[model samples]
Target chain A: MAAGTTSSTEVPAKGAGFPPFKTETFPSQIFWLVITFAFLFVVLWRIAGPRIKGVLVTRRGQIDGDLAKAQSHRADAEGASAAYQSALAAARGRAQALAEENRQRIGGEIDRAKADADAAAQVEIAKAEARIAASRGEARAHVAKAAQDAAIAIVARLTGDTVAADEAASAVRAVTGG
Target chain B: MAMNPMEQFTIKPIVPLHIGGYDVSFTNQSLLMVVVAVAASLFLTLAMSKRSLVPSRAQSMAEMSYEFVANMIQSSTGEDGLKFFPFVFTLFVFVLFSNFFGMIPGSFTVTSQIAVTFALASLVILTVIVTGFARHGIGFLKLFVPKAPLALLFLLVPIEIISFLTRPISLSVRLFANMLAGHTMLAVFAGFVVLLGGAGGVLSVLSIAPMFLIVAIMLLELLVAFLQAYVFAILTCIYLNEALHLHDHH
Candidate 1:
C-alpha cells in the first residue's frame, strides 16, 4: 500500500481529465493558426476597420477646418490693423490742416484790424499838423497888429492934431517922433 | 508518501487524434481554453442581446465594458482613437474573460501557457508593423535611427533597437508569468489543505487560513485580469502612436 501511494505521488498525475496535444507538428499548428488568423482578420476588417477610418477622416476634417478658420481670422485682424493705422494717420493730417487754416484766418483778421488802426492814426496826425500851422500864423499876425496899433497911438498923442482912423497909424507916428 | 493535489501539473494525452500528420491530442489544458473562450462569447452575447436603453444588469456590464474600452481609446489616441475602439474593446473582453474563466474550478488558463500568450503578443506586434509600413512605407525604417547628437546616436541607437524588439517578448512574458505563478501558487496551497486534511493533523484545520488567503488572492487576480488587459491595449496604442508619428518614443 505504501508503495502504491508513493508511485502515484511520484508519477505526477498523468491523463486524468483530458489528453495532451502536440505542438511540435507543423500541420496541426498551421491548421489552428490559419483558423485563428482568418477569424481575426475578418472580424477586425469588417467590424473595426470602418469605424476607425470614419473617426480618422472626421478628425482630419476638423483639424483642417480649424486651420482655415485661424488663417481667415489672422487675415481679418491684419486688415483691421492696417485700416486703423491709415484712419489714424488721415485724422492727424486733417487735424493739423484745420489748425493751420484757423491760425491763418485769425492772423489775417488781426493784420487787417492793425492796418485800419494805423490808417486812422495817420489821418488824425495830418489833421493835427494843419491846425498847428494855422494857429502859428494867426499868432504872428496878432503880434504885428498889436505893435502897429501902439505905434499909431503914440504918434497921435505926440502930434496933438486931429487924424482920420484909416491914416492914424502913420500920422500918429510922425507926430510922436517930431 | 502522500499524493499531492498539484501532482496534476503533468501533461497527459487523452484522445488519440491526429490531423494532417500532426498530433492534436485533446488535453485538460486545451479543454479549459475552449471553456474560457466559449463562456466569454456566451456571456457577452447574452448580455448585449437586449441592447436596452435602461440596461438590465448583464446589459449594463456589457455596456460598461464597451464604454470603458471606448474611453481608453479616445483618451489615449485622441478623437482619432475611435477607429481602433472596436479592436481594443474586443481584445479587452477576450483577455478579461480568459483570466476570469481560469479562476473557476477545474478550468485551464490559456494565458498561463507561453504559446498562447506569445501568439496574442505576436498579433499585436504584427498589427503595429503592418500599420507602420502601410502609413509611412519605407520611411518607417527611420524609427530605428535616433536624431540626436552624432556622438550620442552611436550609443543610443543600438540600445533603442534592442528595447524596441523586446516589446513583444516582454508583453508575452508579463501575462504568461502572472497567470502561471498565480495558478501554481493556488494549486500548491490547495494541495496543502487536501493533504493535511486527510491526515487529521491539527494543522489540517489551520489550512483554512491559507485557504481564505488563496480566495482573497483569487479575487485580486480578477482585478489583475482587467489591469493586464488595459496595459496590453494601452501599449498597443502607444506602439500605434509611434507608428503613426514615427517619433520612436524612447
Candidate 2:
C-alpha cells in the first residue's frame, strides 16, 4: 500500500496549470466539503465530544468535592478545639469554686471550735481559783490554831500552872493581832 | 528533466462523476478528506475504547489533543466558548491529520487546495456571524464599529470592516500558502538532485547537498504542518471569542 501510494503521488510533473487557481475544480471540492465537514461536525457532536466532556466534567467534580471535604474537616477540627478550650476553662472555674467553698467551711469550723475551747478554759480557771482560795483558808486556820496552842503551853509551864481556855485564846489572839 | 512542482496539487479524478451541471466527481482531494476523517475517527474510537481513568499512551494522546483545543477555547473565549468545542476539535483534528497525511511520500495534502481552506475559513466566519447575531443581535455588527473618535471613525470603521471581510481570505491563504510553498520547495529541491545527477558524476556528488536539503525541508515541513494546524485552530478560537463576547474595538 505504501509503495502504491508513493508511486501514484510521486512527481507526476504532468499537471497543467496551478490546480489551486483554476475555478473549474471549486464545485466538487465545495460539495465534498459540505458533505464531509457536516458529517464530521455530526460525528464529533454526537460521539467524540460528549465522551471527552463527560470524563473532564467528572474529573473536575471529583477534585472540587475533595477540596470541599477537606475544608469541612478543617472546620470540624477548629470547632473541636474551641469546644475543648471552653470546656477546660469551665472545668477549671468549677474546681476553683469548690476549693474556695471547702476552705471557707473548714476555716469557719476551726474558728467555732477555737472559741468553744477558750470558753471551756475560762470556766475551768474559775473553778481552780475557788479551790485555791478554800485550801488557803484551811491552811491559815491550822497555822492560827498551832500558834495559840504553843503560846498557851509555854505560859502554863512557865507559871507551873494551867491557864484558863478563854484567857489563853484571848492572849493568843492579841499576840497574833499584834 | 524539467519538473513542475505545482503538479502534486492536481486533483485528479479517481472516480469521475457528473450531477446535472456540477462536476461532483470523486477526486484525490475527496479521497484524502474521507481518509483523514476515518483516520481521526478510528484513532479516537480505539484510543478511548477502554476509557481508563489512567489513560494508556493512545488514550493520553487523544486526551492531550482534547485538552489542547479545550485550553485554546478557554483562553480565547472562556468556558462558555466551549459550546464550539466539537466544531473546533473536529476542525483541528481534520486539519492536523490532513496536513500530516500530505507530508507522507505519496498522499495528497487536502489543505493545499484554496477551495478546501476557503471553505473551512468561511465556515468559521459563518458560525461566528450567525451565533454572534443570534446571541447579541445588532450588537454583532458593532464588531465593525470603531471605538475611536468620530473624526477617526471614517478611517477606523472602514478599515475594521475591510479587515473583517478579509478574514476568510487571509485565513484560507495562510494555510494554503504555507502547505503549497513547503511542498513546492521540497519538490523543487528533490528535482535538483535528479537534475544534478544527470549532468555528470561530479555534479551527482554535488547533488547530495540538494538531497540533504530536501531532508531538512521535509523536517521543516513537518513542523509547519503541525504549526499551521495549531494556528488555524487558535485563530478560530479567537474569532469565536469576538463573536461570543463582542470585544471592545481595538
Candidate 3:
C-alpha cells in the first residue's frame, strides 16, 4: 500500500506537481469558486436576506403595537377605578347629610309636642282649682242654713208658746254675727 | 496499506471541460464548492419558508446565523457598515459551510487550497480599498500615517504601508495554513492507526493510542473550523471598519 501510494503520488507530482500548489488547477478552482460564490451572494442578497429582515421588522412592529394597546387599557382601568371611588364618596356624603337632617327634624317635632302637652296640663289644673273653690263656698252656706234651723226649732220647743217669727229670726242672726 | 495523507489534498478532474484555451475542468474541489453554495442557500431559504412569527427550530438556526453576522458587522464596523451586510454574510456562510462539509470523511476541503483562500482575501481587500478611496479619496492614504513625530513618521509610515499591503497574504495564509495543517495531521494520525492495526501482535492493540488521538484532534478540528470562520468574518469587519472610519477610534 505504501509503495502503491508513493507511485501514484510520484506520477502525479511529476506531471501536475502538488495538487494544492499546482498552477494548472488554479484557474479551474478560481473559476468554480467565483461562479458558486456569486450564485450564493445573489441568492442571499435578493431572496433570503429580505425575508429575514421582513420577519424581524414585522415582529418589532407587532410588539410595539401590543405594548401601546396594553398601556391604553391600563389607563382605562385606572380611570374606571377613580370614577367608582368618587361616586362611592358622593353617595356616602349624601347619606350622611340625610341622616343628620332627619335627626334634627325629629328632635324639633319632639320638643313641640312636649310644649303642647305642658300647656294643656296647666289649663286643666286651673279649671280644677276654680271648681274646688266654688264647691267649698256652697258647702259653707248649707251649714249655716242648718245651724239657723236648729236654733229656731229649739227656741220654739222651750218657750212652748207662740212667739213672733221675726223675733226668732232676729235672735239667730245676732248670735251668728256676734 | 500505507496511505499518503497528501493524496486527500489532490484535485482530480471529475468532468473534463475546456473553455477556449483554459483547462476549466470541474474537479472534486469544484463539486464541493457547488455543494457548499447550494447547501447554504437551501438551509437559509427552506428554514425561513414558513416565515413564522414564532420561529421553529430550523428557523431559529437560520435567524441565529443571520443575527450573528449582523451583530458582528454592527459591533465591528458600526451601523453604517451594515450596507455591506450581504457581502459579509455570504463570506461567513460560505466559509463556514465549506469548513464543516470538509470535516465529513472523503469530502474535499475547498478552503484548504491557497488559491481559494487567496481569492477570498483579495476580495475583502479589494472591497476595502475601493470603498476607502471612494469615500475619502486621497484622505484614505492617511491611514498609513500614524499620529507620531515628524522624525518617526518616516519610519512608521513605511512599516504601516507594508503591513497594509500584506493584509491579503496574512489573511489567506492564516486560513489556508490552518486548514491544511489540521487536515494533514488528522490524516497522518489515521494512517498510524491503520498501519499499526495491520501489523498484528501487540501493535494491533497499541493502535488504540493513535485512534484516541485522532478522536481528540477531530474534536479540536471541529472547533477550529468554527473559530476560523468566525475569525475570517470578524477580520473582514475590522478591515471594512478601517476603510470606512480611517483614523477615527469608532
lDDT of each: 0.66, 0.86, 0.90
Docking class of 2: incorrect
Give per-residue lDDT, candidate 3, residue A75. 100
lDDT of 1 by residue, A1-178 (tens): 1233353335333333311132442233334434543444444346434434444455568789989999999999999999999999999999999999999999999999999999999999999999999998898657555656766667678986645555754554455462
The CA lDDT at B186 in model 2 is 90
**Where's the lowest-lDDT run of ten residues in candidate 3 chain B?**
B1-10
Tell me the deviation in Å of residue B24 in model 3: 1.7
Among these predictions, the greatest DockQ belongs to 3
Q: Please list, in the order the candidates appear, how each scores on TM-score for chain B only.
A: 0.88, 0.97, 0.99
List model 3 lDDT by residue over A36-106, tens digit each: 99999999999899998888788889899999999999999999999999999999999999999999999
Q: Which stretches of candidate 3 lie over 4 Å from their true place?
A: A1-3, A6-18, A117-178, B201-206
Error of 3 at A90 (Å): 2.8
Q: How does each model score on TM-score?
A: 0.60, 0.71, 0.85
lDDT of 2 by residue, A128-162 (tens): 99999999989977877777788779987898778
TM-score preference between candidates 1 and 2, better one:
2
Candidates ranked, most accurate by TM-score first? 3, 2, 1
Chain A TM-score (model 3): 0.65
Candidate 1 residue pairs in clash (backbone atoms < 3 Å): A19-B13, A19-B14, A19-B26, A19-B27, A20-B13, A52-B83, A155-A172, A156-A172
Clashing pairs in 2: none
Overlapping backbone residue pairs in candidate 3 total 0
True contacts kept of 3: 0.70
